[model samples]
Target: MTLSVTPPGTSSGPRSGHRLAVRPTRRVVAPEVRRRRRVQLTWALMVLNVMTFFPGAPHLLPIPGSVGKLIAQGALVGALVMALSVNRPLRVRPSVYVVILMTLAVEALLSSLHAEFLLGALFRACRLFGFALVLWLLTPWWTRRDLLLVRTHLLMLWGIVASVVVGLAVAPGLAMTEDRLGGTLWPIPPTQVGHYSAVAIGLTIVLWMSGLLRRSVALVSVLVCVPVLLLTHTRTALVAVLAGVTLAGISLFTARSRVRKAFAIGLVVFTLGDLTLGSVVTTWLARGQDTAELGALTGRKAVWEAILAQPRSAMEVLFGFGLSNKSFNGLPIDSNWLGTYYDVGLVGCALTVMLVLFVLVAAWFRPQGPHRALALFLVAYCVVASFTESGLSEASPYLLELTLAASLVYSTPTREGPR
Candidate 1:
């Protein structure tokens, strides 16, 4: 006897007269699907922040420049949070929010006394909201997959930045490194190389240490980039990268003394490199000395002194001079506390200091899996580099990336299972 078997969905025997009851196709939502949704929302916010670069025009408004940027950032971040939490409740981390508010208050106090258009700085400050928002969206909650995605983006950005720097270095009659590398255009200036290299090296170290990349690729990248860093002659950049990578290595390999020793050896080589190349080091050192005059050949020390002599009133000291002081063509404003003090005042400077401290602490203390050490290094290096660069301002590309990365680092969550 031959028997025919009907498919579950198809009718058989008496069931042929009725539509068969097909069990509903169960929708199995993988955990990754939910995670991807969060990632998408996070990336969308990042894209929006990136798009602001295309807008070109400085967003100056009555809301104050920093405040306006803040509004824009808040809008994007708020949208992202809302989207991510259709089912899950979205709660702001109190410490993060407090830091942000303090930063704004500092900006506000500075705005009241700023000599130039304080609104410009205000807008700039506001714009950074995106950076902070990015932290909230990506960190502590970020999975290994999300980190991989971040590494991909970072590597691409690093390649582009590196190519730009190298091309400019080789370009004929570029005149000013800052003009070509730090300027706002197709290629940014080298002004914030410290911040840029810090994050790059930090990420590289994280990937290598975490065993995320094949040894060959990581080794090659480190080799190629080291020369570029040297050629750029960005002392602060080197410092940032070394500090961050070393700190990260220390934190990540706390139990592995050999690895820490290796990292220390690398740092020694990196630092002593300038000494080995005697002529180059001497020349760069000479140039640095020449550049130290703060005002009228006084150097930054002089500028700081001049600022110190300004006034004693709490309001004047705290709020600042107001933004309408001086306007320069092509280049953005100077990178110094003097400029900030002259424009915004003591309160602005204090807030600025606090903001830097906050990021460094977060990087230093935040609970990331393998990335904890790396993030700390990046944050520390950035803080140190900011002393000489236009950190926390749209003027620096590296600052933008570092801030973005920091935000992401903090926002991402740790992987649940053991390594």
Candidate 2:
């Protein structure tokens, strides 16, 4: 006798024989559920990006250095991937700015051939490309602007808390120098901490002005960041913060009601007055003056002179000596523009300037609003900070924040009203 088995979800019967009946069920998820899931996933990714900067994360998690970098890079890549999967079909037409950025990346890679360490140069170039990709992917999330802003600030706040906690746990005394508060989570430089604190203050101001943050909370955040900023004692950071706050005030005053305008103007005047009259501020300025009067720029001027002294071929001058080339006679080139010129040459420098100018102009032309003001503030900070430190050169938390700001500025619709 031959016997046959029926497949699942199928029914079969012989004239008088017993038969099995089955039904198929489809598990349909509600659209709202899916949306919530995506939003949560995005928040998690943002947190991961921020946590990558925690000095203790890699060690605490027992992840290798290389693996940690890969994880960070993967998080960015994963965000892009998820966005592409859920969003409308990717557009074939590319933005002009993106094309220019791509060209610059290509130039950087080519210039890397002349670097002292080819692998290092390639790695740097790749990391930059990763950042560009991540930012580009963010352009599609303009519809979720509120969520994006909240997630970003939340992560930033977490970073601040983590830095303080880690600093206090390890080398608290070393973290804060005599008369200066430069506490940092290990692996984060004191200067970087200062820069972070400055930016945080600027962000808090904008958020509070926009009414996205409560006045009490904003005041508390500013108070918390100020001592850290003072401790860092980084002159460039101080200057950048001042420039950012001034720009923010101007932007707010221009776009707000008469009452708000008056407040904005008053705040600006107060900040300027404080910088001028505060004893500690004067002391900082005096220290800088003493260094400048000696023609050393606290050793930065000497580094620049050494770099300029090096004999270079026409090709090298036009296209740079390559990334990470140590032709500075054992001196560190502390300025981003100068470092770019040394690493990538005139062409690279021009590209960097164009990129910065484009972002600045874009932010300036944006309709008067808090987002526009914040973008302008960030761009101003980066521009001023670059003059003293190579803040824009590498893949760090600070650079990541700048990239996010630029992406937000570029992606935001010009006609949208203030949030």
Candidate 3:
């Protein structure tokens, strides 16, 4: 028997009831749509990750107190999953800032060997390690997707800000204690509420000036966030917001016409505010504190002196007593450098200094853009706030903000000339 061959130019039909195989055409998604999807996914995961760290979140949402530990761990697990899901291999240089943070995490674990509260310190150290690991694991995506990374970060921040506002409206009495705002629902410290508001407001202005966000939106954010910020009566947050926004906006003035116009309008608004609200503002800043208390930096100076005066072993001075409750004799340290030293000692303090300085120097040289402006604002805010509040060397909002800034700096393509 002989097989028949199909002739050239002849249409071939199925033989022996066998169908020809067909390769399906793949659907092509638009670049913008894909970017948006990535950003949204990142935003959701970031919200979960950030919620774990936000001062009052675990105390209120998804369960409170001891049960909150599970939620925090789950969030990190989700972050690890997200980080491992990157579609492509990263080819960027290793981020020095990230390395330093990872080092700090290892140091924290080492320092915790003799902590006063062994369990608490170990738990905190583990969380710090998880945070650093998540950040490092996601570096490939964050470095190439800078725009999406920061946009998602801002969205996470705004979510917290909105929660505080809603909490205030829902229960003014619970939100305000002694005239200070701390959402009754979340029950966060008034200072944390103020921190979120101040950061949101500052970043909104910077993103707006950089044309990343709309003017109307930024204006609305400031209008809403300011009230929450003011109600918290957190003078440190207020000062930091002013300094951060001012420095960030300055970077955009030359490139963005809106910045100059806004600056002029702001000057006018400030002048009128000084004229009409000068006494009120001054009184509020005073917060009923006497000169002696104010001179002592609201009693922080004494705490600093006490910390410094306390004798320490050679190893203790070098490594510290390990992380505690971030307090001294039942009182909060209220200072980043001091707290870092108390928790991790002089070595931790040096690493913390490097963390801030590296970001500061990178933002100084980075090309002017929304990312740089944001980096500038976050770094400046952390710097100002560090002197008055702790958390620079630990898994806190300030640490996250600094890490975000570092990612922005490293993710950006560098120029031949420094800004």
Best candidate (score: lDDT): 3
Clashes of 3: 0
**What is the per-residue lDDT of model 3 for residues 1-419, given as tens digits with 9 covering 90 to 100?**
98879898755676676678899999999754664565356436644554433444323344455555465557767765655544234333478988899899999999998988899999888878887876775555455433666667667777777887777777777677688887554546788889988888887888888887877888888898898899899999999989999999898889989899999999999999999999999999999999998999888888899999988999999999888768898788999999999999999999999999999999889888877888899999999999989888877778878887887788555321110
In angstroms, give how far residue 361 of model 2 lies from its true place: 1.5
TM-score of 1: 0.63
- Which is better, 2 or 3, measured by lDDT? 3
Q: What are the runs in model 2 whose C-alpha is more than 4 Å off?
A: 1-94, 142-154, 169-171, 177-186, 257-277, 285-295, 325-330, 393-399, 411-419
lDDT to native, each model:
0.52, 0.65, 0.79
Q: After superposition, how far is residue 349 of candidate 2 from its true place, in Å?
A: 1.0
Put down candidate 1 lDDT per residue, 1-419, tens digits, no spaces: 99999888756665545665689898998765665555545554453344322223212122344553554456466645644563244534445534653464446434643434556655554444445444444443433534644564456557544654555455524414432233222323343333444456567766677666677877766665565555456666776677666676777676555466677887788688856887876676354555434133324444445556855567666666554222233233345455556555666666666656666676666664455655576566766666655444232343445544455455455442111
Q: How do the predictions measure up, each by TM-score?
A: 0.63, 0.75, 0.84
| lDDT by residue for model 2 (184-214), tens | 4434456766777788887877777666778
Question: What shift in Å separates residue 121 of candidate 3 from its native position after superposition?
Answer: 1.3
TM-score of 3: 0.84
